[model samples]
Target chain A: MNEHSLTAEIIAILRKAPSVALFSHVSPDGDCLGSMLAIGLALESLGKTVTFFNPDPVPAGLTFLPGAERVQQVLPQPKPQTLVFVDCTDLRRVSLTPDYLRDSIVVNIDHHISNQRFGHFNWVDDQASACAEIVLSLINQLGVTINRDIATNLYTAIVTDSGCFQYSNTTANTHRLTAELIEVGLNLALIHHNIFDQKPLAQVKLLQAALNTLELRAGGRLAVMSLTLEDFQKSGAQQELSEGLVNHARSIQGVEVAVLLKEVGPQEIKIGLRSNLWLNVNEIAAQFGGGGHKRAAGCTLNVSLAEAKQGVCQAIEEGLEIGRDH
Target chain B: MNEHSLTAEIIAILRKAPSVALFSHVSPDGDCLGSMLAIGLALESLGKTVTFFNPDPVPAGLTFLPGAERVQQVLPQPKPQTLVFVDCTDLRRVSLTPDYLRDSIVVNIDHHISNQRFGHFNWVDDQASACAEIVLSLINQLGVTINRDIATNLYTAIVTDSGCFQYSNTTANTHRLTAELIEVGLNLALIHHNIFDQKPLAQVKLLQAALNTLELRAGGRLAVMSLTLEDFQKSGAQQELSEGLVNHARSIQGVEVAVLLKEVGPQEIKIGLRSNLWLNVNEIAAQFGGGGHKRAAGCTLNVSLAEAKQGVCQAIEEGLEIGRDH
Candidate 1:
């Protein structure tokens, strides 16, 4: 079915359902949490029983969203008439795939290019910078008024997903939508500060430790860094704190490929790879049974930190050499 | 004069002038450089001779601008028909006070709240997020068609000054103008990466050293970090790498006030202060014979680094105590 017809059918299903359960991916981010909460609140306003579900609590940085407190980790015993997933590329990514969810009608909404379309009704728009943007359209199709709270939630989703509109995914529509959201009395300063500026001391400590071990390779074309388990323990930082650390390596001038080896276990290490120019880190990561976008990708190795670092560096070197030949 | 009449008057002046010399503040940022270039290009398109002037060469990051290569550091011996200050808050900020400029008609265009209106004709609109936005208006007033190069320059000016539209200064007009700029074939990703993401390895090294010295004080409400000349030498980082280091301190959770001390000489230290909440660092900076906005400000001390740190910490502690009492 065409997108217009699919949107209309989804709206019809939502309106007729007496109760709806909204789910987002595990380890929920601002886009998923905000989009889910905004839709859940809108449905509740329409006199429909609505429940918000996530595999985990919202990230502390994003708990400032209006309905963030209502996000439940445990799905209610009785399933709702309609089960909707927001921002999940695949149903497996939602984390809580119980038998009950299978019995209920599934609706999938996402913006990821790799969406599996694993739903009875699927609406995926990779062109959208954030799933919250798609939800904005969904809310409009449902003929519900977007209150200030809803506007704030969706705005946070878009802003966070777009990296405050600095990311390449951000488009003219992104700015226009953000402009509309701003008109809804949202406090841009407070939101931007909470999401971007505020960071735990532990995270800064981790960043410092990571930067201390930074090494340049391939005549400064390849940059690599590693974080031992001891470093993490000393820093007292969560694994999530290392999320964007690889970007630091990739950001260095003259670096085409950046690799970060993070020891997650005695014999297990997770590797993050980022490319600034033409090198495809995704292909390299895919060789290790991992996959992601062309510029950013990851893989896990069950080996000592030194072995993992050596293996990844070799792979990156080979990749760069091949790219140069091409 | 009303803003409309002022704009019309400025347009008339630009049309009548056979030659125009454009100038921006010293140590030009993206906003000043972008604004100056856009206006200079627009005036040039009108078949008028335009000379762009700055005390220093354009910053490296902003050198990607189309006409940046033509920006002259030394002013030409002959004076132009009109002397226009693009983004200078005051005439003195332009860094050129030659006798020839003193006799020329000065047109001041700026968006700073503290602009002194020190010109024969002043056009200061603090409401505009960037001076480039006002230049866009001037281009429109002059009936000059905005080509791709002009749009890209103005877009970079707005994006940088508004912190890529994340700062509170970003408004609906900012987004609308950015959207228009994007329509003119502006590569948002390249501009954003150049301005924000791309950083030297030296900068990351400097950040690591700064974070190593991060200290929590006043019950973690005041966070402070300092970098001595030795740290600079060890890191092999330039002085400019410390530009946003104070923000690292401010980003710490529960940090109401953050301070960064950079030892420029044995007895000279420059201090940067950032406030997350109610404390006005500007007032604190004023006490140290410096000034800036309420949240972000700076000052320089000619005392030993230790003394400077002690004095600044005491001022911050007192400010916090007073704020709590109030």
Candidate 2:
């Protein structure tokens, strides 16, 4: 079926359901949480009983999102007959057992290319920069007026996933949808502040420690940065604060691949890989038994930080050599 | 007159002109350069002779912008009868004497609230997020099809001035205009790369040095970061490389006022100040013989770095205290 027809059918199914349980992916980001809350709020306005669930706690920076307090960590008792999964590639992404789908009429909405279509009714639009874009369309078709709260959630989702409209996934449709959200009286200044300007001092200290270890290799095509356990303890930063540090490496001029190695334990190191134009980091991560998208990926190694760094550097150099030959 | 009629009049004037000269403000930014180039390209398509002028050289990162090479730093030998000023608040902003306006039919196009309307024809739309927003409308009215080159320039202008659409000046119209530009077959991924991802390694080292001096005071409401002359020498970074170091201080959670002090010479320090919300940084800056907008301002201190930091801190604390009582 065409996208419009599928959307109509999903809307019909949602309208008829008496109650719905909305689930977001584990380690919920602004896209999943905002997508879930936006649709859940719309469903509630339609007089349907709605419950929101996420396997992990919302990140501290995103806790101010509208309806964020309603997202419970535990699964709802007496599971609703209808279930909606937002921004999830598959059921496992939500950390739920397959039994949850046994009797429920599952509806999946996502923008990931890897979505497995685990839902009885799936509306997967990989063209969308964020699943919230799809949810905005759904809300419009359901005849719900987008208020400030809904607009805030939808705008945050789009900005987060699209890197504030800097990513390749951002299309004309993304900006048009954002325009619509802005027209709904969204306080963009406050939203941008709440989402982006709340970095802790510890996070800055952690970044300082990370930058001190910056190294360039392979004719400046690969940039590497590492953070030892002592760096974390001295900076007083948690592991999650290490997020986005690899971007600093990837942003360097002429660098095709950027890697960040973090010592999580005495013998375990976490590796994050990012690429600019080419050189799929996912394939390199797969060699280490980990994987993600073409541009970003991650892996874990049961070795010391130095050993993991050496191994990843060798693998990345080989990959660059192959790319150059091609 | 209303905006539409004024725009129409300006279009009529441009359509009749034999030749045009475009001028950008000193220390040209993306909005000025992009706006000037977009209009110049459109006029060239219409078979009108066009020349571009800037008082300063284009920044290295922006050299890839379409028609960037054509921006001459010196005044044209034979000035065109029609002279256009883009993204300039006043005639002096172009670093040219008012004599240039003596005989020419001056056209002033800008979005700054302080624009002096120094042109026989002026279109200063303060509501515009970027001067390019106004230029886009003018190009459309001039019956010029937005090709990839023109679209690329206009998109850069909008993105840079809007802080990638994160700033408060961005409106529904900004995104709507950007959507039109994207539809013209612009390569957004490459544009984003050229504009944001080409950070020099020295800039990162400079950022590391600045972050090392990070300090929070006034109960975390004030964040101060300083970089000494020795820090610059150690990082091997120039003065301009300190452009965004203040932002690192501003992004910290609970920081209302963020300050960066860069020691340029013996007993000479440059001060950059940014406020997140309430405090009028412009007022504070004026008291120190410097002035700018409310949210961002700058000044130079003849005192030592320690004295500069102490004076600014005391002034900011008083400002914060006053804001609290209000």
Candidate 3:
């Protein structure tokens, strides 16, 4: 369906629905959690029963969202008349049983270009910076007065998904909508600090360990960093804290491609690749039986850390050469 | 003068001036640099001879600004008809000879709360998030169309001064202006990447060394980190790279006060202090012959690093105790 008609259909179904259930991808981040909460709160305000479901618990950093505590692991009873999937590119990402909800009207709302139209009503806009941006438009169309609490949730979603407005996906309309949301009295600092700052001591320790092993290749064009299992144990940091570590390597002045290899087991390693402008790491991840976006991609290699590092760095060098030639 | 009349007076002067000279504080930050460039570019487009002056060279990160190369270290000849001091809390900050332009009409434009209004026309609005915001208004009132270059400069000013819109000073108007600037075809990601993401490898090395010495004082209520001159020399990092090191310490989960002591010489030490919520560090800095806002402050001590750290940490502990009692 065209975006206009799909949006209208979704709105029409939502307005008359007796109950609505919201599902987001597993291991939800700020965008999914904030989008779910904002829409659920809006529906509740309209006197409709709303159930928010997440396959995995909200990450530690994003629990501050207003309605985060209400997210349930299992689908609620009294089957929802309307099922809205937000921020999930694939239906399996939601990790919910597909058999029971066959009768309900399905609505897929996402901002990802890769979103599969797994719903009866699909409204996907790749240009939207975040799913929350789409939700904001829907709320405005529904004539719902966005209260302060709802505004805060929406703001969190945009800020996190846009990397606090630093990402390329952030557009002019993103800032305009953010301005309108702030008008509803959002505390930009409190939310920003709680989300970006307030890092645990262990995280910094892990960062230190990760940087200690930093290496440069391709005449400073490639930056490689690694963390052994021992480093995580020594720092008392969980493996999750290693997230964004490769970005550190990519931040180097002359580096184009950054790779991080983490030892998950004695002979197993997880490889992450990040590129600055030109190099496409997704193809490199595909060779390793995984894939992601152009600038960021990842894969798991059942090889020793040293072997994985050598193979990934060689692949990135070839990619960079190809990119330069192009 | 009231803010309304002050803004009107400045606008009137700019409209009629044959030429204008722009002055920002020495060691200019993103806000000052961005504000100066935006206004100067706008005036230059109006066929006015504009001279942009800064006592210190543009910092490495901000040299990406469009007009950064045009900023002069020394005063230019044929004095301008109008002298506009932007982003300066005090006249001395501009560091220009006081006698050279004593008779010129001085316009002080700032957003700092402590501005002294030391200008024939003063437009100081602390409520405005950044001085760049004020410049945006003045350009609009002057009826100058904001081009892509001017928009980039103004956006840089706001993003830097507002800490990427995370600081408390950011308001609804800030985002609105940012959205307008974005509409002018500013590349948000390129500017953000150049300003925030492109850190030198030396800076990361310096960070590693500083984190190695991370110390917790006052029973974990205070976190302290120190780096000696040798550490800078060995890591190939300059003293300026230590600007935000204290923020890392302040980010610890429970730490109320975070301090960074840098050895400037055998005896002199440069100190930076940051507070999360309670316990005013500015008062503590004042006790040591320095002062600033309640949360972030700085000072210099002509004592050994060991002595300075001990004294400052004790003062912070006492302040925390007093704050708790209150």
Question: Who wins the TM-score comparison?
Answer: 2
> What is candidate 2's local distance difference test score?
0.93
Isolated chain B TM-score per model: 0.89, 0.91, 0.89
Writing each residue's lDDT as its tens digit, candidate 1 over A1-326 gives: 99889999999999999999898988788899999999998998899988888888788788889988988999865877799989998767877545656678889999999998888899999999999889999998899988888998999999889988888888888878777777778888888778876788888888888888999998899989899999899989878889898888888887889888899889999999998767888899998899898989999999899988888888888887777565
| Poorest 10 consecutive residues by lDDT, candidate 3 chain B | B94-103
CA lDDT, every prediction?
0.87, 0.93, 0.88
- Scanning candidate 2 chain B in windows of ten residues, the lowest lDDT window is B317-326
For model 3, how does the per-residue alpha-carbon lDDT over B1-326 read when each residue is reduced to its tens digit?
Answer: 67677778888899889899999998899999999999999998888889999999998888899999999998878777699999999878987555755889998899999997788888888999899999999999988999998998899999999988888998889999999999998877678768877788888888888888998887888999999999999988989887887888888877889999999889999899998877787888899999998889889999999999898988888888787665
In CAPRI terms, where does candidate 1 land? medium
TM-score of candidate 2 relative to the true fold:
0.93
For model 2 the local lDDT of residue B258 reads 95
Evaluated on chain B only, what is the TM-score of candidate 3?
0.89
Q: Encode model 2's per-residue lDDT on B1-326: one tens digit a residue.
A: 88788888899989998799999999899999999999999999999999999999998889989999999998887988899999999978998778779988999999999999999989999999999999999999999999999999999999999999988899999999999999998989889888888898888988888887899999999999999999888888889989978988998999999999999999999999999877899988998999898999999999999999999999999999888555
TM match of model 3 to true structure: 0.92
Write one digit per residue (lDDT tens) for candidate 1, span B1-326: 89788888889999999999888888888899999999999999999999989988887788888799989988865877688998888767876554555677889999998888877789998889999888988898899988988988998899889977877788878887777777777777677767766687788888888888889999999999999999889878879889987888898888889999999888999999999767899999999999999999999999998999999999989999888565
Taking the tens digit of each residue's C-alpha lDDT, what string does model 3 give over A1-326? 67688788889988999799999999898899999999999989999999999989877778788989999998779777799999999878998666756888998899999998888888899999999999999988777899987898899999989988888899989989999999998777678767876688888888888888899899899999999989988988888888988888889887888898999788889998898877888999999998998889999999889999989888888887777675
**Separate DockQ for every predicted complex:** 0.67, 0.80, 0.66
Cα displacement (angstroms), candidate 2, residue A206, comes to 1.6
